[model samples]
Target: IDAMLEGFEVSKENFSTNFNGELLIITITLLSFLGLYYSAEKLTSRTSLTVSSKPLAIGLMIAIGIGLHNLGEGLAIGAAIGLGQVALSTFLIVGFALHNTTEGIAIASPLAKTKSPISKIIILGLIAGSPAIFGTWIGGFFYSPYTAIVFLSIGAGAIFQVALIILKWLYQSEQKLVQASIVSGVGVGMLIMYLTSILV
Candidate 1:
């Protein structure tokens, strides 16, 4: 099959199904997000002399990461619905809904440590939730493996940055018990996701 995209031929042989292209995109996207996060952290530290701004920025950054992650989940749910897999779509919607609730807490946990206002928490919740709905709408009409890969890559980049920032917070707290619990939580979360994948 002939596939023309942006004046370039995108064939099965030439597209990112190959290892090198996939690696390049993954590396570039991850590094770019890391760079962005690093720069933002530095710039915010320099400019934000006020106390409130920093927390708001941190909350917003976390919300963005979780939002992108949820959007990827929405894409999966939307694609399933698009493909007429009603049962699979339903299962995914329910599962993602439950998963995102935990994700919200993950987003909130750092801020919860601080004295965040109720209004800010509500805003972050909307930021994290709106993307899923938007992504589902987008996914219903468009179906492309390449597009999905891009979405997933961006989401992974953002989510990884959030994890790194949280790790730094954990280090600062100097609470061994909290760190151990985090490690245990990671193990349990991975196990659950692995088991759930088997169902699909």
Candidate 2:
């Protein structure tokens, strides 16, 4: 496929596929939502700055989960670009960039409580997120089904583990109201997901 340089000029055929790549993309997207869910849960359950240290670790874990998912999304972007899917490439960049900004705040919130040195916090945040940059570059340069599948699966697994951790933390919380809210949020999120999956 010829490289597309202009808006609306990139053929959807070049960007769209029915094979492993598209499946991997969708899988990564769902997992990204899982990360978002965990992040919201953590923020609501406990503040990193004002809450217990136990939940602080959970918050960090959530950040890690988001980072991994973002890496897979980045890989999709790169892979699409590698295939000359310019419009898809642009979409991925914009979406991921916006997601990353929110992730930065989510990650920094808890770490801010530690009163940790700015240098250390910066390093940690970058460490958590740097993989996405490399993953995207690799996916964009080489079209490898095996690589994409492996990274996508790994990313999803990371997010899933964090979700489990969040559940456990919620279960252990002493406040009934907080626990109820967490349960309600998760129930609503899952219901919305079901409806959207069916409708979309």
Candidate 3:
């Protein structure tokens, strides 16, 4: 969602600039993110060789991924408010507040399954969720297209890495439903994001 929507704005603005090479910049930014996601996934997957603190590491990885993704969401809100799109921003806030309930499930479920301590889970929850508020503060005051582009790309990358890891985990479980679940999950997530988009 971050990459597609924000990248659209960036590409359009760049086009309006008569191809001032912002398109190139956007392309490079996206490719960089894709590369980063690939590298991170490769590195993290190698952790199967290590046993100690595996659960803690996995929990932290999920938290970091969630934080990165929400940072982009915050950027959208902050950017909209910065542009004086009050109605859009308000709708976004309302939509996001509702959407975040599901996000809370995503953040907590893996940690709970790992039997992480309650205190640690609480702390991880904070780590996973604070970025939207913080990003809003930054975006509202310091909003820049390039900045948003960079952060959004990074966030998208982090989110992809987490998804890849989760899918890999599910694959190792030898479940016949892996492909269907992945497809269904993607469809549902896209649908939700699309529904939220109507608020704008």
Q: Which prediction has the highest TM-score against the true structure?
A: 1
Per-residue lDDT tens digits for candidate 2, residues 123-164, read 657756888888889888874665656566657656665556
Every model's TM-score: 0.77, 0.56, 0.75
As a TM-score, model 1 comes out at 0.77
The reply for model 3, stretches above 4 Å from the true place, is 14-52, 173-191
- CA lDDT of each candidate? 0.67, 0.59, 0.69
In model 2, the runs with Cα more than 4 Å from the true position are 1-60, 169-200
lDDT of 3: 0.69
TM-score of predicted model 3? Answer: 0.75
Q: Any residue pairs clashing in model 2, and if so which?
A: 78-140
Residue-by-residue lDDT tens digits, candidate 1, 38-143: 8558845864686656656666777887787667667777888999999999888767766666577676776766787889899999998899888788779885
What lDDT score goes with residue 16 in model 1? 51
Cα deviation of 181, candidate 3, in Å:
8.4
Please identify model 1 stretches exceeding 4 Å from their true place.
Answer: 1-21, 39-48, 173-184, 191-200
lDDT of 1: 0.67
The lowest-lDDT stretch of 10 consecutive residues in candidate 3 is 20-29
